[model samples]
Target: MTVYKQLLSLPENFSFRINLDYLKSTEDGLFRTDQESITRFIVLDGNLFFIKIYVSNNNRLVIETEDVSQSYTKQFERQIMLYIRDWFDLDIHLEPFYTIAKQDEYLKMPISKFYGLRNIGIPDIFEAFVWAILGQQINLSFASTLKDRFIKNYGKRLIHNGEDYWLFPSPRLIASLSMDELFKIGMSRRKCEYIRGIARLIANNQISREKLVQLSDINLAVKQLTAIKGIGPWTANYVLLRCVRYPNAFPINDVGLHNALKLAGSLDRKPSIDEIKQIASAWEGYESYATFFLWRLVY
Candidate 1:
């Protein structure tokens, strides 16, 4: 039972309070949230770690890690920190976003109401893909319910302090699963096959996060990801935005974005695609951040 601890200095313009509130806004079974702390398990380089993070007295992020029955190395510790940094989007500067948003009508409210908020992300590619697939054409509430059931049924877990902490199922495990088993979780047949196909690609080593990240163009990465059966434009853009950290990823046709825009702009009805495109044209390079802030309005 080895433990590792680290204190991270949060970059400027980070509001732990706002980010915590955003995490608390949803009841995803992925992570357990407390009044001031959040805990979840991450598998890095095939080693499992149960990690807990909270704000310290000095406003630094205090990270606590427990290797699941194995000794860990300093290299693994650095990986853990990188994972945490990406999870909270700590390294990116938000001032540029703030500056651009101050003059935009739709972005103004989201930025103000959720000031200091980062685009909290899923750094795990497989997990991000699964989440995007499950969320397709469904409300977030039902998607979360399906995720809880799927994880409990197939994923690895550990009991800590009388509570069960679950890791999202591995690609290999999902790849080995049958259609009937996945169907029992309430996902559509198309979604089931899509997830299995993605799992197979990942488990077979045909696709990887590193490969995508190394691509010279984000568009090429998007093209490759969208080549998968289940990953369309929306899912590809979503995974890229959340996991790969692409600044230009945007899901223009997303209903949530439309609704958030409607609410943000006080429109009598949801904005049309053309209207949204026109409005978002001003936010060319920062579409992902803009969409994230808008989504924060609802969930």
Candidate 2:
């Protein structure tokens, strides 16, 4: 019944490139299918700008702009699309698996269907870190409930056309909040300290998005992130996948992934970490893509 507009330019295959499918699985807030979230009812223009969208259950959004200059529209649409997708993670590229992926029956189905599924990408560096941490040892539903409360208490929001859209909290905002504040939302003391420590690092520029990207060696980034109190291999790998666009990144110990693999391949039991590594070996440089494909099997 109403419309809101943002000049979003979507790059070609930006949806596929950014691993939108991956983000949808990992990032709890961004890609919601529930009636309250409008992320699923999305469409794109030639330049990949989110020129039109309609959330089916609660309401509808119609683009009402009359500035219909095709040339200008296309150009600006491209810019806007790219910005939103990158901001929300819609154009990240993961290396391909080549022959190994082609040879694997498990991968063939997913590889073919990947572009059709929503690729997941996380744009917020700090939020990604926090999410990776929060999800460390919990079930997805519980993690989401915690995230809902966490964001509602700490995140900033914008009211557009009487609709509320939330922006994940910034480091500075989070750093200023007391641990007791976060704890009130069901976070354990250890998780609170972990979040605060990460915020302090980001606030002081001791660690930065740019710094992570600048490091060509993924090992170094993982090491640096692990140095933070509660961050470990899974968190670091999750951050790498969502924030830095690292292709080979996969949270090996993840229960969802472990189970998804077993189900996808029709195995009776979960694969050991070493077996998981070997199974993923053929996928090689595209472990992230393979991971994304496998993760899809469960959802």
Candidate 3:
């Protein structure tokens, strides 16, 4: 390991507390967090590093790593900065979203309640695809449980300070596993096949974040992703929203989105897809953020 320590500055108006609250809302076994810091494993330039991120009393963000040395080039620093920015969605300007949402009925309350909350993203394409597939038709809690099991069984682990930090299984690892191996982890055979197929596509370079990111149009991106087996409109849009950071990606069929809208409108039943679409039309360019804010209502 390279021997050095460093501090990274964050953008102005950053709210570590809000982001930490969102992170702690879910019980993720892969990363460990406390009131003071969040510890997770990150792979940079094929070298795995355990990173601890915390905020100083002066409201500055600090990223601590033990692997900074003469060998760490400017490219590595750029990669690290990009990863941190994407993970926290630091580039999005929320003032316009807030302005648009303030006039809207469905998003007014949620936006107010969860102000400063960014749509935390999954930076890894393979992890995002597998997560979207694993969560199909299942409730969020059980999906999280299955994810914990899958990660612990197939993912790499690093023990730091007597705690294990896990990296989500890579495509190469998943592609090499047999169907029976994944099914043994309590995932259905269909789910297993879907994940394995995605893994094979990724491992072979048939699909990648680089390719997806090249598509400037959100509809084109959705169409490209949906062509893969087991990836439907909802999954495609979900991946686009969470992983690709496409502002217009909207999963109108999402149950959580529907439920949140229903609760927000005080409706007797869940809103139909068309109704949700009509309601969402007001926030055209920032539908992903609106959807994320609504998810916060029920999740």
Itemize residue pairs with steric clashes in candidate 1.
none
TM-scores for every predicted model: 0.96, 0.75, 0.95
Please list the Cα RMSD from the true structure of every candidate, rounded to 1 decimal place: 1.4, 6.9, 1.8
lDDT per model vs. reference: 0.88, 0.65, 0.85
Candidate 2 C-alpha lDDT tens digits along 1-299: 32335433443333332243344455444333332233421223422111333223222222222232233455554554464555445355433453455568667666565643333556568878888778878877887888888877787554434545455777898888898888998878999999988998898999877888899888888888888889999999888886777777878888878887887678899989999888887776667767766777775
Ranking by lDDT: 1, 3, 2
User: How many clashes (backbone N, Cα, C below 3 Å) per candidate?
Assistant: 0, 27, 0
The Cα RMSD of model 2 versus the native structure comes to 6.9
Q: Report how far off residue 208 is in candidate 1 (Å).
A: 1.3
Of models 1 and 2, which has the larger TM-score?
1
List residue ranges in candidate 3 displaced over 4 A. 1-13, 68-71
Q: Give candidate 2 misplaced runs (Cα > 4 Å).
A: 1-81, 85-95, 98-102, 117-119
Candidate 1 Cα misplacement greater than 4 A, ranges: none
Most accurate candidate by lDDT: 1
lDDT of 3 by residue, 1-299 (tens): 66334566666546788788888986466677799888786888686666778888777767776562334666766777678789889888778888999888998888778877888898889888988988999998888889899989998877887988788898999999999999998899999999999999999999988898889998899888888889999999988888989999999889999999988888999988778878888998999999999999888
